[model samples]
Each structure stands twice: as C-alpha cells, then as structure tokens.
Target: MTAVFDTFYADDTLVDHLTKSIQYSIQSGGKRIRPLFLLETLQAFGIPISEAHFKVAAAVELIHTSSLIHDDLPAMDNDDFRRGQLTNHKVYGEAQAILAGDALLLDPYLLLSSADLNASVIVALVAELAYASGSHGMVAGQVLDMDGEQHTLTVDQLKKIHALKTGRMLTFPFVAAGIIAEQDDEIVALLRQLGEAVGQAFQIRDDILDVTATFEEIGKTPGKDVVADKSTYVKLLGLDGAKQALTEYLDIASQMLTEIEHKTQLQGEPILKQIERLRID
Candidate 1:
C-alpha cells in the first residue's frame, strides 16, 4: 500500500505537495481492519489472492482515509489529532486537507474501474462501495451523529447511527468478496447481517474506550464524546451497559460467522479469530 502511494503521482511541485499530503495520511498507521476483512473473506472462499484483490483492498483503505481526513475538519469533529499524530488539517491547511480527502475519495473509483477483473465484478463492487460510502450509508450516519450532539439519543437511535456510520463500511469487505466469488443472494444477505453485527460491536468498543482508555492507549483523543456532548453507547448505556451491548453484538456476529462457515463448509477460523479479538474484556 505504501508502495502504491509512493508512486501515486508525478514531479510537478504543486502535485507533489498534494500527493505528499495524501501519502502522509495513508502512511499514518491504522488497524487496516477493512482491507484485512476483505482479504479474509476472500480467503474463506478459497479464492486465490490476486493483484485485483489488492487493488480492491487499497481502494477500501483510500475511502477510509478520506473519511478520516474530512471527519477531522474544523466543521466536523474538529479533532486535532488522529492515530496519535496531528490531524491532517492541523498539519496541512484546511483547504489542502479537504482537497486531499476529496482526491482520495475519488481515486478508488479509478482503481476499481481499471482493475483487471471481469466487468460484472467491477460493476458490482462499484455499486456496493458507492451505496456504502454515500448518503444512505456513512454520510447518513455522520449527519445523524452531528445532529444528535448536545442531545440525548435513544438506544435504537444510537444503534441506527452507528449501523449506518460504521457498520455499512465494515460490512463492505464481506459483501464485495461475496460478489467477486459469485456467492448467491442468500449468502450475501448473511454476510450483510454479520457485517452489521460486527460493526455495532466495533462502535460499542470505541465508545467504551472513549471513557475507559487513555489517549496513549487508544491513539486518539479520549473522552471527546463526552466533551463534544455526542450521543454514544457509553453516554446512553453507561460503562457496564455499553459493555453488555458489545457482548450481545459480538455474540450475534460470531453466530452469523458460524452459520456462514457451516453452510459453506469453509474454514472460517481466520475471520472468527479476528472477531474474538474484539472482546472488550
């Protein structure tokens, strides 16, 4: 991935500066969970890892990085730090940061379009990615989250927010893999459910960490939810109740994975192990 970004641009000074900003954003270490999820889903289907798969994975990361850059803007979360480093807008000017994010978001479509895969597969991937990242998905979640600030949110409302904001993107890898591997609609539906469950658990853990983990421990500003007065599992459920919710989502995710494994008779241990690591306790 670093190599891809290294040669992502040419020698013009202005272009070089812009590319550098994008590179800096990508080079900053993250969990890389989204791409890993895609790869693992492919592996479970016994699909050979190919350059196309890597391209798809890179596309996913680019979209995620773009979101982070935008999310940290002064108009948004206004976060000054991410992944234990200064936020992009803090390092680069806000205009550059915004453009960089916009560039990153659009580049993925170019990648997917040019990938050496069947037209059908590429089309399916593009459609799913657009829906996941667009208004009905992550954007919707962010709007709801922003709107819910300074006001208490019901449990169902909170779940709906996370489900759109976090869960849709998390679920993309699995659904994309199923599309590439030509899985049936029933299997694809199951993968979507599993993705939703895992996404909910993932967000709950994030809420728990906000209250319980330190900045150094979590690699981002801690307790910002409270400071921002954003509605989160911790704010609504308390620490113990939020934790209980995490367990329930994890259990649901695990059960769905087991069902997928049994139905497909595939070795799902790799993905299952990843879910196990999400346990808050």
Candidate 2:
C-alpha cells in the first residue's frame, strides 16, 4: 500500500508555484483509494505490479486528489480539512488552488504518455481516464451534486448523482483493468458491479457519518449535509433504512465477484476483499 509518488510529482519552472502547491496538497496523505483500485484491479488480473504500477497509481491519485482540492474551494463544497489537513484553497489561496487542480488533471496524462507502456495503450488509457475524471464522470457528478442540494430528490434522482460522483470513479478501475489486462467484457462488468456497490455503500456510510460523526473525529466540519438539508439516504429512507440499503447492495456486489475468484483470486485487495469477505460471512 506504500507507493512512492515522487516521479509523478516534479519541478517545472513555468508552473513552479502551482506545482509546489499541488505537491504540498498531495503530500498530505489521503486514502489513495482510486489508484489502489486501479493497481489492485490490474493485479487482480494477474499483472505483477512494479514501478510502473506505482507510477500509474500516483497519476490516478493525483487526479483524484486534485479534484478534491478544487471541490473544497469557496465556490464548491467550501470547507477546511481535506486528507486530514488544510484543504488546498484554504492553504494556497483560491487562485493557486485552481491552477494546481488544473495542473494535476493535465499532468497525469503527460506522465502516462511518457511511461514505458505501449503507446496506444497509454494514449487510450489517458483519454479514458481524462474522460472519466472530467466532464463525463466526476466533474459531471459534482455539478449534479451541487444541483441536488438545491432541491429535494427522489431515489432515482439520488441514484443518478451517486452513479456519477461516487460510482463512476469506483467503476473506473474495472474498465482500466480490462484495458491493461486485455480482459473480457464479462469480467469487467462484474468488477464494475462490485466497484459500484462498494462506492454506493461508501456513500451511504458517508451519509451515516454526516449524521453521526463529529467535526473532530471525521476531520472536517460535521453535518454539512444536514446544513444543506440535502436529500440523502438518511433524509429519504431514515437511518436504519439507509444502512439496510447499503448492506443489501453490498451483498449483491459480493455475489458478483463469485464469478471471478476461480480465476483472478482478487480477494487480496482490501476493498474487494472486505466486501466479499463480509458477504461470505
């Protein structure tokens, strides 16, 4: 789980300030979930991870973390703590945080393009990653999330927001793994299901936390969702019902992985293993 991020982070005279800011922001040590998913997904397909895996992992994490930086700005989610430290906008000023986020988004492909992977593979992965992290996925999800808070939403409406904000990024590794491993679509689909369920459950946990956790324990201001009066699972179905939904979908996701264990033995990955292990028990 300890991956070095040095190579993907570098010095550029032109973007010096932004680079420093982004690097500082990344150095704060976030969960590294997306990159872990990408790495583990590749490993799940029997790819022996090496320096290249670390490189790709860093690139993915940088993209994800950069999004968080922009996401927490005054115009966005607007809070203080991120990755358990001062958020980029709070520490670097809003403008620098913006440029840092832009740099982080573009720099990953630049790094990936320069990597030792097959040219076409790198290009396609870069393009797909950009699309998923950009307008078609995470960015779109954020816009919808903002809009979601502005009004009440039905279950379908909330699900759409989760599919983008939480699910797409989670599903990303499944597709990226297939691309890198040359896997069949069927396996990729199963993995996507697992990823989405993991994300949905994770989002539900977040909602539960919003109601239950404190500003100190959770490392950020608590009850922002309550403040927003946003229609969360808690607001929609009640807390017990929300937890049950998380459990039910997570169980369904666990069942999906049974089709793959005979091959990949992917049960070693923490997130995947945790879900599957829970289901089996």
Model 1 misplacement above 4 A: 7-14
lDDT of each structure?
0.89, 0.74
Indicate the worst ten consecutive residues by lDDT in candidate 1.
5-14
Model 2 agreement with the true structure over 153-265: per-residue lDDT tens digits: 99888887887887777777666776777766677677777777777776777787788877766777778888877889989999888878878878777666666665555
Clashes of each: 0, 0
lDDT of 1 at 170: 95
User: Model 1: clashing residue pairs?
Assistant: none
TM-score against truth, every candidate: 0.97, 0.90
